[model samples]
Target: MERFNKSRVILMPCRDYDEEEIYRQLQVGIRLLGGLEGLIEKREKILLKPNLVRKAEVDRAVITHPAVMGALARILREEGYENIICGDSCGIGTASRTMAGTGMERQMEKYGIPVTDFSHPVKVDYPQGHQAKQFVIAQDALDADAIINVCKMKTHALERVTGAVKNMYGCVCGLQKAKGHTLYPNAESFARMLIDLNQLLKPRLYLMDGIVAMEGNGPTSGDPVKMGVMLLSADPIALDAVFCRLVDLDPQMVPTNVHGMQYGLGTWKTEEIEVFTPDGEVSMEEAVSRWGNPGYRVDREKYGKNIWNALKALKIFQKKPYIVEEKCRRCGICVESCPVEGKAVTFKNGRENIPVYNYRKCIRCFCCQEMCPHKAIEVK
Candidate 1:
C-alpha cells in the first residue's frame, strides 16, 4: 500500500447552476481521474453508493442529493458502463424505506438504474489489524466491480465531519451499524474503526457532493450552506482534508484524518497537498476563498476536559431524560427500552403515565432517543 499526499486532491468548480449543467461539471471532474473507462470496465457491474443517512428531502440536506446521483449515473452510462445500481442503509430505518422516502427509487428509475438493498452482510477480516478483527459488509457492495462513493459534506455528532471516508461505513449494512457503535463506543476508537474499514473496502473512486454542505450539528439536524464546489480524488483521506480546509476547520481536529495519517492512509498537512482546479490553473488560496467558512465553534479544551471527566466519573455521570410534557403522549417506549436491572425508567400511576428517568443507573447510550416514536426524549 502506498501513502497519498495532498497533491492527489482535484477540486473542480461547478460553473453550471442547473442540474444538467452540474452533471457536465461532474464528468469533467471524473475525467481528470482517467475517466470511467478504466475505472469501470465495459459492462462491469457498478455500485453508486451514496450517503442516505435518513429519509429526508434533498432540500433538507440530510442525505446525498438525488440529482447528483442522477448526474453520475447518466455520465457512467454515456461512457458505455452498464449494469449500474444505487443503494445504502439509513440509520433509523431500512434501505428500501429510505430509498422510497428520499425519492432515490424514482431517480434510479428515471435513469433505468436498479436499486438493491444492502442488508445482507458477510464477514471480512482486516489483516492490517487497526481495531476489530473483522467487519460485516453488505454482499452487494463487495460483489460490485467498483464502488463510486458519493458522500455528502456534513458535520457528524460522533465523527465531527462525515465525508468520503465516513461514507464507506454504509457498506457495513443497516442494523449492524448500531452494533459497530456498541463495539467502539468512544469517538476516537470509532474513528480508528472507520479507517480500518476504508482500507479493507477501498472504493475505486471518491467524490464529495459539496454543492450544499451541512454545518453546525449535522449528519442529522444542521443548517445547510451552499458550498458551490465539488471534489474528486482517488484518496478518500486527501479529499476529506480538502473539505475540512474549505470550511476553515482544522483537519487535525478531525479524528479520522488524524488516525488515517498515523496509519498511512493519507496526508494531514496542507502545504504538502497539490490542488488542481477546473480551469487549468488557480491558486489554492483563491479556490479555498470561494468556499466561505461556515462559522462552527469547536471548543477544544472544554470538550476534551468534559469527555475525560465523564469517563472518570462513570458512575456519577447522570443521564437525565427531560420529558417535554406538552409533547409526551403517555407512551411507555422509554420504560421498555431501559436496560438497567432496577428499571430506571418507570411509568407514573395517574399522571399521564409519564415515564420517570432514574439517572443513577442510566448508561446514557440514548437508546431512549432511538426508540421514542414521538420524539419526546431528550438526553442531557
Candidate 2:
C-alpha cells in the first residue's frame, strides 16, 4: 500500500559470508533503513523466514546463506531484540530436518533461537483477491509480530526469478504449495495468486542473500554464480524489480512483479526506483552497470498464451518429468508431493520402489522436479 517507499532500495557490497564482515555490512544496510531504533522495539519477537527450499547446502545457493542469516540474528540480538525464531515450510520433509540439512539450525541455535516447522496451518479467505479466493497459510506466518522475509536470489521455473515476493509461497505450508500450482496452472494465473498470498502475509521488511545466487534453471537444479551483493527493501515488488534489472532482464517479464504492481504490492518500474549504497544514492542504471549480471538469467519458455494454451490442451509442451534410474533413490517423495487426486507419478508400476509417471494424468507442475533432492527427476 505504501509503495515500498517509492522504490527506494539499499544496496550494500558484500562479497562473502565471513562472520565479522557480513555482520558489519548487515548493520550498515539496516542503518540505511533507520536501524532498529525506528523499525523494531526492544523485546519484540521477530520471525526470520529464510529460503529453506528443499534442504540444500548454502553453497548451492538454493536457500539463504546461513552465515548471513546468523549474523543478522546476532545483530538483532545486540539491538535488544532477543526473541527470534527461523522457520519455513519446506517442500518435501519436515522443517526441522530441512533446517538441519541446509545448515541454518546450527547458526540459529548459537543465538538461543529455535527453528519451528510451520506445519500446522489455518485456512484464510481472500475475497478481494484477483485470482485466489482462499488459502491455507502457515500459522507462524500469521502469528509472528513481525516478519522479515529473508530470501535467496534465484531463478524459478514457474515464476522465472525467485526473489522476495516468491519466497512467501513457503508460508503456505508443505504440499499445499503443490495444490496451489494445481489450482492455478497457468503462469499468469499463478503469479496473481502469489500476489494474493503476499498481500495476506504482509512482510514488514525484505532482505536478500545475493553473495552467490543461482542462475539458469533454478530454485533448485542450477549453478551458483558469484553476484556478491546483499539487498534490503521495504517493498518486495520494487525489490524484485531492482533485482530483475541487476540480472539484465526486463522486470515486466517477471510475473510476480508484473502482477504485484496491479495489486498495489510495490513498484515494478526500475526507472522510478531510488537506489542507495555507501557511496550515496545511485541511479538504477548506474547500479546495474556497476553491480549487475549481463550474461546470467533464468530459463523461460517462449510461447504466447494462446499458443501455450493450445499446446497445453494437447499436452504438447512436453516438459514432463522423467526419472534417472541411477540417480533415483526411490524416495517416493515425488509420489507423495503430487497434488493430483490419483497421484500423477506413482510407485504402483511394481518395480520394487521405483516410481513411474503417467504423463497423461500429470499436471506438469514440476513439483516432482522441484522436490527431488537427489536430482533424479529431470524435465525435458
Candidate 3:
C-alpha cells in the first residue's frame, strides 16, 4: 500500500479574495506541486468540484469563494486547459441554487463555464469497500479527464473536520447523501464510505479554501472564523491530516482521514509530508508551531462515540429534528428535503405554515436541519 505516497501541501497567506492576487498565488501553489503541466495535460477536460452546499452569502464562508474559482479557471485557461466545468451535489439543496446563492453563477456566466447539477449518476462497484460495496456518483465526475477538488475547510458535527477527503461526499448526488447518513449514522462507517468514494474518484488535485473557515456545528450550521490560509495538495488524506494538526486537533479523531489511512489512501504521518510555503519548504514541526491553535476549533470526541453511533444507526437511539415554532416560516423545504417515505416532518393542519415532526418514522438524518433556510430545525 502506497498510503505514504509523498506529496506537497503548499500554504499561502491569502487575506482577501482579490482576483489577480488569487490567480497569482494559485500559480505559485501549482508550481510547488511540480507545475500544472506536470499534473494536468494540454487541452483536457477538467472538473472544478467546489463546496457550495446551500444558499448563503459569499462572506458567510459556507461555500468556496467564487473569486478563488474564477482565478483558478483563468489560470487553467492560460495554461491551455480548456473545457473547465464546475459542479457539486449539495447536502441540503440543488447545486444550481447553491452555486447561484454562493455567487458562483455570476462567475460561471462571466467565464462562460457550464454548471452540471449532478442530479444524474451511474452506479459503480467498489470491491474493496468496507462499508459501501458500490456507489452511485454523478456521471460528470466519473467522465472528467481530471478532477480538481476545490474544497472548503470547515467543522462537521459528525466528521470532526471537512476538508479534502470529506469534500468527495458531494459526488454521491441528490437524496443518496441522506440515505448514507441514515445507513451509516456512526462516524466510522460514514468515513469508510467517504474513503471509498474518494478512492473511486481518485482526484488528481485537491485545493482547500481555508481563508475563512467555520467552527462549532458546521458543514452547514456553524459560525465563520477567519484562518486566512490557502492549502493545495495532491494527496487528500495528507492534506486533511495536516489541517487537523494545524488546528491542534487529532488526525486520528477525524474519521475520514483515519479510515483513509486504514485503506491505504495517503500518509497521516507529519514526517512523511513536505509542506511548501511561498518562502520555501518547512519542517512539519515548524509548520505546526506557526499555524497550531487558531484560537477557535471544532473538537472531535471519540469516547464511546462508536457505540452511541451504532445505537443511532439502529434507531435504538435517535436525535430527532425539532422545529422552532417562532422561526418556522412554513416554507415546506424541510418536508421536501426529508428522505423518509411518508416524510418525517410535515405542516400542521395542512396550513403549510407550521412544521410537525413524526418522531417514529424519522431516520434522524438531519436533512431538515441541514436544509432549513431559517434555522428553525433543531435536533434533540
Most lDDT-accurate candidate: 2
Q: Per-residue lDDT of 42-64 in model 3, one digit per residue for the tens? A: 77788889987787888877888
Ranking by lDDT: 2, 3, 1
- lDDT measured at residue 339 in model 2 versus the true structure, 0 to 100: 86
- Summed backbone clashes in each candidate are 3, 0, 0
Q: Once model 2 is optimally superposed onto the true structure by TM-score, how far is the C-alpha of residue 109 displaced, in angstroms?
A: 1.7
Candidate lDDT (C-alpha), each: 0.73, 0.83, 0.80
lDDT per residue (tens digit) for residues 178-202 in model 2 = 8898899866888999899888878
Candidate 1: tens digits of C-alpha lDDT, residues 1-380: 13233446678665433678678778777776656675668867888899877666677677787778878888887787778888776665766677685566777888888877787789888777598778989998888878889998887655668899889888887667767866775567888998998787778788888788887546655567778777888778878988888877778888899898888777767776667765654555776776546464321222446777776467454334566767788777667655455666777565566787776655554445444556576544
In TM-score terms, which candidate is top?
2
- Candidate 2 contains a number of clashing pairs equal to 0
Runs of candidate 2 with Cα error greater than 4 angstroms are 1-5, 324-326, 347-349, 352-354
Which wins on TM-score, candidate 1 or candidate 3? Answer: 3
State which candidate, 1 or 2, has the greater TM-score.
2
